[model samples]
Target: MSGESAPRATVGSESLERAFGGTAACNACGARVAEYRVVALFLHETAAIRAYCARCYPAAADGDYHAGGDGLRLDYAAFAARFGAPGPPPPPTTPVDRMLAALVADPALRLLAPGSEAVARRRRRVPYPVRVGFALDGATSEARMSVAPDGRMTDLAGDPAACDRVRALLAGI
Candidate 1:
């Protein structure tokens, strides 16, 4: 197995059909495939996620599986450049982000919050609003964190304890 490679399924083959579909394409080569592992450099609201094929992906790279997108081929080197050694992950969510996700999903939360604009602002203020929403239900809220375009937590509600806790959590990161 050291020198051998995993068999490549044809684009329309059944094996490929079963495994692939939503996988992201390689950032550099644009190979839409499911064979590569995903290498994500955790970013704030989003992840600099990339996929690498067994051949194109780094054999020694570590991270999650690569799901393809568009028609991009996996590019292991480029992915490594971005993710490298990701800084500490985001903090756990406040009670607010969690509630909003559930509400967004059920449509009831959006209806009940003060107003659409207010709710939106709260979402922006919350940690990892896009990913860790309802998933981190009771995750210490104190550790909940988010990343903004400027690469820092833009807002944390500033309720003393919450602000201090997150500030400490994101200190050098």
Candidate 2:
């Protein structure tokens, strides 16, 4: 799958009818198809979701059939990359960066004090607000995690145990 060949994401014979309502070109075949696979990864989200007709679909490269679902598993390599990346995401430039990296690396994310969960400025007398949230890849409304000048961490609504854990993870940042 790597010998100077890479499949570009595209759909042949695409049209408005197929995209919105009528016939859309199938991903595997150029024929105008209306139905897309429940798990198809279309080149374009606005277009049909990389659906194939009854004939083209149902074929699995790994030949593994999933129960109660039709999505052919993509991202085998992506899965490998995620797990294969040694250590953590990388060192951060800011307190929030360290906090985020730690959180993402920690598979056992949960509330330490009673709920769920960075940074430096051990010298600064003023506390600064750091926003945290669930969404990683996109922008989200973040809950505040403040850092007291003397190195006191406040996660969410000032959960002490959670702060301690987060602090341990983000030490020396």
Candidate 3:
């Protein structure tokens, strides 16, 4: 590696330090270093080395670079070819969809179709039903929701944890 262009140490040195015990953040995304996270170190034509989190590294790979030397070179096309194109974005979520996703986030919970007879039968066998039914409506503030086995429409608007998880997931999208 060129002493001036590349670091005397190998790539990911900071990430390694942070992973072991030190604290470091990705220069690109500002994400804290973590053991499971992948960080890429890029040496630019200006002789500046930058660190990026996995999500931001792909974009960085496309930047301009100098000729290959010191075992460091940025090949945008090759890098993109090595990693296939990203998939299409997820479909947008409506309020009812968010509500349903939150309701079913629990492993034991199930979303059942409305007026399903199996829901009634399952309710009869257990004190508490594990299923929930919902009707999606773009006009409503929240989906019309009902607990299984009882089949009574109720509101989960007061559920903070469920609402939080749903909001977090939506925000990530």
> By lDDT, who's the top model here?
1
Clashing pairs in 2: 18-23, 18-24, 42-50, 111-115, 111-116
- For residues 14-80, could you state the per-residue lDDT of candidate 1 as single tens digits? 2322333556465335576665554332222222334455565553132222222322222233323
What overall lDDT, based on C-alpha atoms, would model 2 receive against the true structure? 0.32
**RMSD of candidate 3 to true structure, Å:** 19.5
Say which prediction, candidate 1 or candidate 2, comes out ahead on lDDT.
1
**Per-prediction TM-score, please?**
0.24, 0.26, 0.21
Off by over 4 Å in 2: 1-95, 111-144, 147-157
Q: lDDT per residue, candidate 2, 80-148, as tens digits?
A: 242232123323134333344354333233211101111122223245454333322332222346655
Clash tally, candidates in order: 25, 5, 0
lDDT (tens digit, per residue) of candidate 3 on 97-148: 3333334332222122211222233336432222232222321122223443
List ranges where model 1 is wrong by over 4 Å: 1-24, 59-173
Name the 10 consecutive residues with the lowest summed lDDT in model 3: 64-73
Winner by TM-score: 2
Error of 1 at 125 (Å): 34
